[model samples]
Each structure stands twice: as structure tokens, then as C-alpha cells.
Target chain A: MSVVSAEALRERPVEAVPEDAHDDGLAPRAKFLPSLGAVYRAQLSRARVARIPLLFVATFQSIGIMILMRGVVDQGGREAQAVVAGSAVLVVAFVALNLLAQYFGQLRAAGGLDHYATLPVPPASVVLGAAGAYASFTVPGTVVTAVVGCAMFDLPLTHLWVLAAVIPLAGAALSGLGAALGLLAPRPELATLLGQLGMSAALLLGVLPADRMPEFVQYARDLLPSTYGVEAFARTFGDHPDWATVLLDLGVCAGVGVASLAVATWAYRRAAVR
Target chain B: MCAVRGLSKTYPAARGRRGAPGTPAVRATDDVRLDIRRGEIFGLLGPNGAGKSTLVRQLTGLMRPDSGSVEILGHDIVRYPERAARILAYLGQESTALDELTVSLAAETTGRLRGLSLKDARAERDDVLEELGLTALAARPLKKLSGGQRRLACFAAALVGRRPLLVLDEPTTGMDPVARRAVWAAVDRRRAERGATVLLVTHNVIEAETVLDRVAVLDQGRVIACDSPAGLKERVAGEVRVELVWREKAPMELSEVARLRERAVESGRRWSLRLAPDEARSAVAAVTGGPAFDFLDDFTLATPSLEDVYLALGGSRSGVKGLVKA
Candidate 1:
């Protein structure tokens, strides 16, 4: 009864997956998107019950930062506009990314993946369902933060309708990144630390006026997914916004959202099987 | 019905604190093979680290085997995990409930995941909770439940949809006798009403002995034996145990008692003598009808049982300790 190590097994290449693996005749299999609505509803209810308070905190924290920035920046300028919009989008990142990291991390640490793993639902639905739920929590907070920040900075409130699009776009990018970090981290404590650090990084890079940053720091800001979202919303506050540039920024946000969420789904699949 | 062939899985060796690795790799499951027939309660019996959970995981498609094939109802599960999942329901070794969810919510969500409509899922969840006598605790959050209560809640969730195949890993762990019996009754009902196949993994051999139509005994990632409870007990047949107690004033010296140990395994007042099937009556008569018959307080004959076969098949303390080391 001597046991052989996995390393020994790894020396041999894996057997090719058989074509029969994809056969549907064995049992009545669920479609890839089957019960997505049910999954989404369950996740949303769980988030509403457990995460609403945190959403409020994220909103207040963003507004408080905007009020603080009002003292340094003059009213009705591009700097003020960036401060207002950046702080608002920052709320979405806070809950969607930071909180989600902790949620999935704790889920993995607690053996919660087994619950989803044995279910007939596709892996993508689990990731997307959770991410969508966490992202939804950002909407009320993001909207409240935007309105309060605009009032404090004396920016035009007329263009506030843009937040409807901005909240979801920013939420998708940040929530996906958050879910990936949580699922990938080996330890729950490490995931929490990474989540907090990620939020702080977003605050430092996304909230500050880009003109004042060093050339290299500005490049780092551009690398962040939330920066394009903030820039897209910030441009909308102007008298004559550049529709082309705004669409480009939002498109970048949407593209990064898809990529990050895809990675998160991949991470979930990897963690679940192990 | 399910069949597993050539199932094997190896996990990377864990490094010691000093950084030296013990085994190059640990075979969690080693060339194991098994078949679970329809409408039978099949038991996977083993000590800790004996690959019971590993085998269950492989069958459920939660983990892929390094080398093996799992076919459910003649469909290869490895190639068609989703299809396998459709007919099979798994209650893993770990509790699978979201702490934020209430007991009913968790059960309802599970039913929904199993493809019930919202209304039907809710109805099924309520029915299951009530059937399991957990209706009182249905509104409580999972985090607020005791360990046994949580286990029962998750067990109810698993039973909600009643798929054809049910694989439960240590389902009765940490449960009170009442709750344990409730789960057993539920399992029995599933088998009786639906002809559902149940593959149960458990350390409670005595409890399993009553329900298992067939069982496989695993040791150190290998299936050392597989048979019905009676069939396995029959393997160690012809052996009989006689329990006796001496009269308070009997003339048996310590040395004489030591000599008696040569033929019998003694425990306190009980002497388990190994007598052949034909010799049992005469041996009992000789011990109870001889000169010491008047000095004997009591005597009884005990037949060989599955527990005896289990221990005789190297499922002793040291054997399990070796498995733990691996």
C-alpha cells in the first residue's frame, strides 16, 4: 500500500479527452445558459441581504473623498469634473472589486465551490451570476455618489443620465477582476489583503487628476480598467463632449470587462476542479 | 447504475516542515474498480484517507481521474459530465450551503439549480424541509445553525430533487441519532419509491451493515474486498466465540488462566474462543458442562460478524495509521 506521488504521474502526458466526452446521449444535460435567470436571482437576493450595508459605506466613502477634493480644485473646470466622476466610479470599484474578492475568496476557503461544482449549471453562469450580483450592488451607490459629488463640486447635474451606462460598465470591469483575485488566491486572508490593496490602488490612480501625475504614473493609470470608465464619464460633464473619444473610452471599458470576466470564469473552473 | 474501471488519482506529495518530501506522490486512488447496481444501497467503507472520498469525487465528476472511466447508465461520465450530473445528485464530504442564505433559500436554490421552476422549487424546498422535520429552522440563516443542523439542512437540499443516482459522502457525520435515523429513512424511501441508486461513503460500518446491499472495503487507496455484508461475513465463517465468567470462589490460578489464553482471546470476563463450526456445541458443553460447570456464572456463544471480517482483513488500528501517514 505504498502511495505514489502526483509528481510521478505528471511525468506522463495526460490522455487525450475522448470525443465521447461531448456526447449528449448519456443523460439529459443542461444547456450552457440554463437557469441563468434563476442563478442571477439567487445571487442578487444573497447580495442584497448580506452586502447592502457595504454598498452604503462605499458610496459614503466616495462622496467624502469628493468633498475633500473640492477644497483643492476650482469649481466648473475639467479638474473638478474628473474629481467628481472619478470618485463616483470609484464607489463601483470599491464594492464590485474589493468586496467581491473577499466574497469569492471566503467562498473558496470554505469549500463553497463544491456547491456549484456539482450543479448542472455551466461554470460561466456561476462566475457571471455572482459578478452580476456584486456589480448590481454598485448601481445605487454609484448613482448616489455621482449626484452628491456633482452637487459638492458644482458640476452640471444635467448629464447625470450617463451614470446609467457608466455604473454597469465600470462594475463589470472591477467585479470580474475582484472575482478572479478571490478565486485565485490561496488564502482567504491574502485575498482580503489583495482586495483592500486593489481598492487603494484604484483610489490612488483613478481619483487624482491625470495631468498632475508623473509620465510613468499616468501610464499605470491607463493600465487600470476603471480609469477608462472614469474618463468616459468625466468627458460627459463638458458643454460639448467629444462623442467619438467618449465612445472609445466606454468601448475600452466594455472590452476589458469581457476579458476580465472571462478570466474570472476560468479561475472559477480551475479552483472548482481542485 | 454506475460502473468504474481502472480509476486512479495521484496528488502531489506534501513537503515536511524541514522541506524534505516523504513520498514522491500519494496515490489517492489506485486502480480501483467498482459497480453500483440500480435500486441498491451500496456502501463505500474505509478509514480516513482510504480513498473513499476520492472515489466518490471521481464518480460525481467533481474531479477527473488520472486514469479511469466512469459510466452511468452506460454513458461515460468523464466524456459527458453534464449528462452524468443530470441524473446524479451528490452530497459532498463538505457542507455545501452559503452561510448568508436561510435554510429554505439554500434548499430552494438547490432545487432551482436542479432545473425546477421558481414556484416548483419553492414548493419542493418547503416539502423537503417539512419532511425532514427542519421546518422550524427553515427561516434561520445557515451561519446561525449548529454543525449537525447545518449538515441536515444540506442533506435536505441534496434530497430535494431526488435524481436517480445519489452519492453521499459521510452524510451522517456529526448528526444526532434522531437526525441520523431521519436521513436513513429518507434514503430508504428514495430507494423504495423511486428505485434510486445510492452510493454511500461512511466510517459507520455498523450502521451501514444494516442498509448496504453490497459494499467495498478500501484500504490505502485500494479496494481490498467487495461483496455483500453477508458474503463478506461468510469469508471468516466456521469461527465461533464463547464468552464465560468464573465463579467468585473458583479454583483457577493466574498461571492456569494464562494457559487458557493460549486458546482464547480474553477481555475481562469474556473469553472469545475460536471454535470450528462443528466443534462449537461440544466446546461450549465442555466448558459449561465440565467440573467448572458448577463454578461458571454465565456463558454465551457469539458468531463471526462483518466487524470481525473487517478487522481480519487488515483494517486494524496500525493499518489505518499507515494510511494516515501516506
Candidate 2:
């Protein structure tokens, strides 16, 4: 063999050698098998380490709000349940709003897309990995929100498994949407504006009771995923278990998650190739 | 081994530009073709806006060519990028280091991603850190390092993969002469010990000449010349000239010595002669033959170098006009 070809053969791993050869016995496996889980874990670890301050603030805020709500519930005033439920919905929205905004903002500002594009992993893997990091970062807030919501408002712990599933699903859905928004936004300033608009829309649909709103407003609220989240959380606090409502909410959140994830995947691929 | 054939790239024109009543595409690469042999240090020399980085990006599978094919180690970059990526290591002109991560962690992570075991990764990291003189700042975050140090760290990350092919885009930029030499030494070692192929994109001709086995010069997205450094220098027409100066005035002028030798053999007094285009041997013989030649104080011989060829071929104003005409 010529020198160039010989050098090329020497660089190949033993597994890539032909079967007829009496060379080192090794078998070739599938090539370019991307380890999505490994990439996800790395991204999660990086984000977790970088967002320490945000985590601290979320923890303290959750505790303080829980304490304040407990005191309000002790007063036993008329319409206290209504006020407590409204406050719970507002708190959930606040936590979700801040977490999503911060996560997306950081992703854009850090040039995370550029970093992932040059990796050996596929573009889909990069998108999922970044989304997974945001998902992991929201876990602490999701847990704190559910735990505090139940304890402070004297809410029942029935159907705990379903509630446990709901929190992470909600967090993932919101985070996915946020990631898509971050990808689409031209700049940080635009992202902030769009984030505020999203938060405002969510608050209007989520914190206020549909029955209290006018007919047209209630009809509009049905289009939003946040309305389903509010219904699910409120039903958990009530005496009757609304299984159908819970299923519908989970289905809608899952659909939104899937759609946003698709957007993120497309955006990531475009960014990589460009 | 990497091969790029008939590659072309055009960037979209920006908005609000009036040209022929429509926006025109900026042709970044124009039907460029080259083959990088295994275990050889090939240099791509070009000035700014010469599309060297674009070509490098295409070979490394960072970008798809608008038209043409790029195969890395027998795998087509467009059709099988993942397979190509396993054996190819790319260090872009821009620093790709995560500012928050320590230098050691960046190298370790790069190794891990390339499928190195943790123990092996750590061992390799230490070896590379020591080799690049980065041991003292291994624990420091990338943000803390100077521009040159950060570039070195990025280079170390690229080397950590231990892939068979390395594509370096301006690798020695922001490096001191000692550090640059050290990098060249490491690159040479890789080619010698592991038979690694390296594609170096650089504009610094002097530094590149030390390591490149062959060079391709690109001008405005086209390959104008491709050959070994010595071969390229030989293409330029010139003769080696030697000038000899004595402490005192010589009895005969340099031209007189040449004409007198052609006419007849004559005894000579103390004389210093400057050899013409092709007369070094006879001139040296006649000078040494006389006793006065023993007092020769200093002599210097100058020949055409790569820099001179580069200037004649690319730097001259008329050369560019000629190329355009051709």
C-alpha cells in the first residue's frame, strides 16, 4: 500500500478492521450513535452549576409565600378560600413566569446554540439537551410550589401520584415554550417583551376564575393551556375529583410541549447548518 | 484524509442593496478543489476574505457546501457527518471555549465527548497541559486567561480528541514565538508518532513555512498556486549572487576579473570579486588561487527565498492584474 493509504488504515480502530484479517479481534458497531442521555446530563450539570443564585432565590421565595399564605388561611374570614385559591394560582404563575424567562434569557445570552452546533451530536440532540437542562432547573421550584400550595392552603394530599406527574409535565411544557420563544426572538430585548406578553396572558387566564369573567373572556380562556393548569390545580384543592378535567389538562400541556419541542428542533437545526 | 471537490458557497446579499435591480449573492468559495494527504501538515495560505475559514468549515462538517462534495476519511461530510466527525478534529478561528469552565475541565470534557475513558481522559489532560505549558493555569477558568492563553487552551482541547485528522484555522494566532514553536513541535510529534493529518489555515507565511509540507495559496476564493515551499521558490527566476568585500580596496574591479579570466590566465594581485549569475565556482577558484585572496575579511551569498517568490507571485500589483486577466 502507498504511504498515505497505509497511514489512513493505521488510524482506524481495531473494530473497523475486516473480518478476514487476523488483526486484533474486535467488531464494528453502529457508527455515529449519538448518546442523547449523555449530552442531556452534561447540559443539565452545566446549567445547574451556573444557576445557583436563581435556585436560592426560588427556594426562599417559595418558603416566604407559603408562610404568608398559612397566616392568611388562619384568619378564617368570609371568601377566604376564594382569596387563597386566587393567591395560589398567582404564585404558580409567578414561579413559572420567572423561571421560564430566566432560563430562556440565559440560553440566548450565553451563545449556547453556537456551542452545541459544533459538537458531534445531532441538532435534535442539542435541542433536547438544552431543553432538558431547563427542565432540570425548574424541578426545585415545581416541588416547592406543589408542597407549599398543599400545606399553606390546607389542601388535600389525595391523588398524590397524579399531582407529582402534573408538576414536572407543567414545568417541561412551559420550559419548552420558553425555549422556542428564545429561539425565535431576534434579541434579548425582544425576548423580554414577548416573555412579558406571555406572562400577562397566562396570568389573565390562570389567576382569575372563569366563572367571574364575562362570557366572551371565558370562551377565550379555553384556548390557553394555562387555563387547564389552573383548573387542574383548583380541582385538586376542591372536594370532588375532576378526573376528566385533569386528563384534558395533561393532554393539552403535552400537546403544547410537543409543538414547542418541534419548533426548538427546527430552530436548532437551522442554527447549526447556517 | 479529507477531499473537497468543486466546492462553492454564496452568501445572501443584505437587504436594501440596489444591484442590477435585484440582490446578488456574494460568492465566498468558487469551485475550489484540493486533497489533504494523511500524516502531512498542509498549509492553506491566503489573505483576509480568501475563504480559507469557509473551506475549513465545510471540510469539518460545520457547514454544508452549496454545491460539491467533501469527504473526510472516506465518509461524505454531507451524507454521513457523524461518521466523519469521529475521526476529524476542528479548531475554528474563533475560540470555542466555555468561559465559565476551567481550562482542565474543558480539555477533559472534550476528551470525554470523543469517547475516552475517564482515567484516560485525565491522564491525557495532564499530558497535554504540561506539553502546552498550561499546568500552572489548568484550574483557572477560561475568562481569567489572556487572549493568547485562551487560544492555547482551545488548541489543547482540539488535540485532546486524539483524532486522526486535525483541522486548525489560524491555530498560532495570539501566540508568542516560543509558544508557537512548541505547538509546531507537538503537531510534528503527532504526525510522526500517530500519523495524523493536519490542515492548517494561516496567513502568516513565515510561521507556516516551518511546518507545512505543501502549501496552497488562495486568492479571492480561488486556488492560484499549490506546491511545496521550495518548489514555489524555484519557480521564480533568479541566480544566487555572492558579494565578497575585503578590508582594503582591491586592485581590479569585479567585472575586470571576469573578462580577464575569459581572455587569458594571468597572475593576480589582491582582489575581491563579486560572482555574477552563474560564475561562483571559477570566481572562487581564481580568488583562492592568489595569495592576496587569503586576506578576505567578509563574504555573503544571497538567494531567492519563499518570501521573495510570494511577493513576486501574489504581492506585486501587476501579478494580481495578470491573474485577473488570466
Error of 1 at A207 (Å): 1.1
> On residues A1-274, what C-alpha lDDT tens digit does candidate 2 reach at each position?
0222445446743343223222221112112323355455555655555666766565555456556646544423222333333333333334444445544555555454434455565555555655656566656664556556566556665644564556555555665666666666767666666666765666566544455689888888777655655566556555766788878877887787777778867765665555
Candidate 2 chain B least-lDDT 10 residues: B317-326
TM-score of each: 0.83, 0.70
Q: Write the per-residue lDDT of candidate 1 for residues B118-232, one digit (tens) a residue.
A: 7877898988898689999988877789888888898888887658778888887778888887788777766655566799987776766777889999887999899999999
Every model's DockQ: 0.21, 0.09
Q: Give the range where candidate 1 chain A is weakest over 10 consecutive residues by summed lDDT.
A: A13-22
Off by over 4 Å in 2: A1-34, A55-115, A144-163, A184-196, A208-230, A239-244, B17-24, B95-97, B116-127, B133-139, B176-182, B235-311, B315-326
RMSD of 1: 9.5
Error of 1 at B219 (Å): 0.6
**Top-scoring candidate (DockQ):** 1
Error of 2 at B114 (Å): 3.0
Error of 1 at A98 (Å): 2.0
Clash pairs for candidate 1: A4-B25, A4-B26, A5-B24, A5-B25, A5-B26, A6-B25, A21-B79
Clashes of 1: 7
